[model samples]
Target: MRIERSNWEQRTLGEFFDLQMGKTPSRKDLSLWEDGDTPWVSISDMKESRYISDTKEHLPYQTIAECRIPIIPVGTVIMSFKLTIGKTCIVSKPLTTNEAIMAFYPKKGIEVNSSFLAYALSALKWKGNRAVKGVTINKKTISEKNFSLPPIGLQDNIAAELDAIQEVIDGYKDQIADLDALAQSIFLETFGDPISNPKGWKTELISKFGRIVTGNTPSRAISDYYNSQDIEWIKTDNIVKDLLTPTTAYEYLSFEGAKKGRIVKSGSILICCIAGSLQSIGRCCLTDRSLAFNQQINAIECDVNHIPLFVYCLIKASQQLLIDTASTGMKHILSKSDLSSICLPVPPLELQQQFANKIASIEQQKDLLRQQLADAEMLMAERMQYYFS
Candidate 1:
């Protein structure tokens, strides 16, 4: 269905929807929170894509009543207005958000399409730093700032097309996730229990096969040390996703900064060693060039006899074991000693090469699916812009 851009009309966001900011109830009021049924959402619960229906925390009706936080209905547009600015999602169920989120309810006859709003918000060139306030920044306040929206009917049509493409993207995502699980299952079945490495192949501690180099962070006070592009710097947040190749989602650092922190050479495996990212313990990527990582990460230079990809797969397969062994507290951390003690199965070079080749084939297929998903999404976005200019 072709949509003519001229058919669409425009209006400010505030004109189309009633924007509601959220409030945080007093933490000291424990009585208000007991056995809460209301789903309470925070920025942490907001994913980059797709509506979030579940949250890690919940609140009681009493808390909701006392706080007077608005319960946004399903299909309402929710956006992160603070730390993670501009990211948006629709509510799939009745939920209340923290001060970090802004909820938008379509005004009568305006009929804002939730998915359209989400994609539009994602594409918005939001000036997040401008929204910062004293002490703690708030997204709710930021979302109140004005933006434009397309005509109601056009928005609906575009959203419908986008939603269809989104389903395809979702299918690809599901397939990738399933394939990853299948690979993990294969690893477990082939190696037996993660702890034992039961094939009884030569087992050796990580320290025996690689050189561990700890990372450091340059002073944040020196602003000149950072650059928009210079050297890729890996952080804990970048470890959550799979990367067949090294890529950083954020800004690179200057050569000086690279020198300040230990230079992580290309092909060296980067591992997260901090608390907040304990689950990212064994996450590894081969850097394209020498880069700097913060103190929370460590660079492991593999020996010539071992393939970097194979070691990464082995470590990834053992990630759960590492997490289970992590120290208990509000935060979980993997110490240098703990990392050094991790044992891995040493398969013959020929076998390792074959396994690497097989995994690469699977990864290539996954990557193609991912690219198709991306292209589909991009086409949808472009079509929306054309349909609702």
Candidate 2:
């Protein structure tokens, strides 16, 4: 039954739309996959889009036919239901998702507008059964939640206002991507592409420049090992490619715990060596301060021959190669020896310093853009509250 509000018709979301769960193809069957046009999507693919069309992985049309994986049509609203929750987007183009996502398709004769629903669904918080590890939402949980829907004309108007706000957010994000591209360009101009060696730069094995050390966690049985002071514990989750994001979730430690893992000075380069998901393997983060990391991570320190930022770029450049070499048996693991085996072109110290100088300037501009992006995000948040509340 739809409840009549003063200016809106209230209906449970399940009453308004038919839910379609996503499916993943069996990994054992290699024949099911081939390079083709269909977007094989996961939650990570929707990271930057309001309407999802493209994905990191593409599936052949045959895979869709044989696997019986439902390819969601354009304009269906999709929300992540596991690991990450409440991440919603409308399918602007045809795509398929993994099991973690669910698509909400307008039911027969239901005139619920897609534009307004996409934005509203984002603000719809699932209040039941969110475990410490992750959040899960099911049909029963979704059915109990009330959704207020405006008339079609009013929905269009609100969507227009929200779209205007989204444009500003998108603009700021574009600038951030451009700035990252500029840094890559500068590195290429100075050292040439690492793979091509177009400028004929000398190459050296990574082992020549730095020492790699894997960290360890003190025995969890000893509760006192974790509660001490003056140390920051770094986990794989703390590692991020973006320098702006702060990694915090400090597990403090005393001498007994610190001795178990590698400790490096500030400005050390960190790589995620072990991860449950392959997407995170080979991801790198630079520590602004000294920290201790667990067994899932490996750190490199080159206080003598290499500039920290330059070393960061070089390590970042080799990420794909590192991912390729990572052992994918049970957990994705990039071993210390595997990292040592890789090589990079050693540009002159002065050239590397010049590249670092360019990064310093680019970083300042990025900080300003990040501020603008933050403001745009706030405006979007305010609009969501204004309309949904």
Candidate 3:
């Protein structure tokens, strides 16, 4: 059933809900923190597009009383109004968020589904008027925004439909995780412990199969070099778990910048050598064309005779092995020596091809499911706009 926009009533967010910001308890008062019974939510707890049932930290009962932080009731719509603007979630339980977060509590007689509100907030492209620098501690912006509200029954219906769609997406995500685990298990089963390949395949150093090319970051001093339409530059931040293609990245450099950094050709496998995200290791993407990478990334130009997909799978399967061999420090470092020693079951080209073909079919299925989920989410957003415009 389609609901006409004229049937819905409009209201400002501040009028329909009570917006409250949280406060941090004193760190020096350890006793206050220990005895607190309230769930303390940080920005990390609010996953942008996921349902949040529990927080990482909890505050003492006394801390809640002393701090005067309002206990945001269950069904409240919470959002990150600071560092990560526009990301929103609905609390499944009574929770107290950090200073960085702002909670929207629906006022009495002003009914709105928590899920619907969250979706609406998520769809909104919020561009705040003020420049939010990190100079002020606990700084946040919770402006009174407006949204269209349907009848209470209609709101519940919309939420239920979205919840069902979200469940399907969640199932796909769980399946992907399971598939990843299965792949790792299969790799380990085929190859014994770290040093030995159980299949007894002949071992070859990494340098034997490919040339290692270390990346360099073009000087950031020249601001004119960065352009949105420039050559795609891959960065460590662009690497996501199980992501074969990088859809988004920061700061693209000009063709001149690519030349200065020694442009990496298409099909070159990119590996991050940075510290902040040490666990984010293998990001082997077959770039469409030559592009620039930062100094922290190492690109491997594999021989054409060898399949790039096969190499990527091998690296992905051996991620744990590389992590195990990584040097212990604040940052895990995978040295060239460590990478060189990693071995794979060198099956015949025909067998590798067959395996790749099977994996490709599975990946295609995964992609279709992903696209379906995206479409559902888009439909939900459009419905929200119609009801709340």
lDDT-wise, the better of 2 and 3 is 2
lDDT (C-alpha, whole model) for all candidates: 0.73, 0.81, 0.68
Model 3 misplaced stretches (Cα beyond 4 Å): 1-7, 28-38, 48-50, 60-70, 124-143, 192-205, 217-232, 248-257, 260-267, 281-292, 304-307, 320-358
Candidate 3 or 2, higher TM-score: 2
TM-score against truth, every candidate: 0.75, 0.81, 0.74
lDDT score for candidate 1 against the true structure:
0.73
Error of 2 at 44 (Å): 4.9
Model 2, residue 198: what's the lDDT?
84
Model with the higher TM-score, candidate 1 or 2: 2
Poorest 10 consecutive residues by lDDT, candidate 2:
241-250
Cα displacement (angstroms), candidate 1, residue 252, comes to 8.5
Using lDDT as the measure, what is the rank order of every candidate, best first? 2, 1, 3
Cα TM-score of candidate 3: 0.74
Q: Across residues 1-389, which tens digit of lDDT does each residue of candidate 2 receive?
A: 22234788778878888887877888787766667688988888878578888988878888888778899999888988777778888898898888878888877877767878888888887765767777677767776689888888888988998889898889988898899888888888878778677898788887777778888888888878787886888888788676532288457776678684478777778888898888788788777787788888888887577887888887777678788889997799988888888777888888889888899899889989989989989988887877776
Please provide, for model 3 over 38-92, each residue's C-alpha lDDT reduced to its tens digit, 9 standing for 90 to 100.
Answer: 7888877776455666777788776788889878877678877776676787777
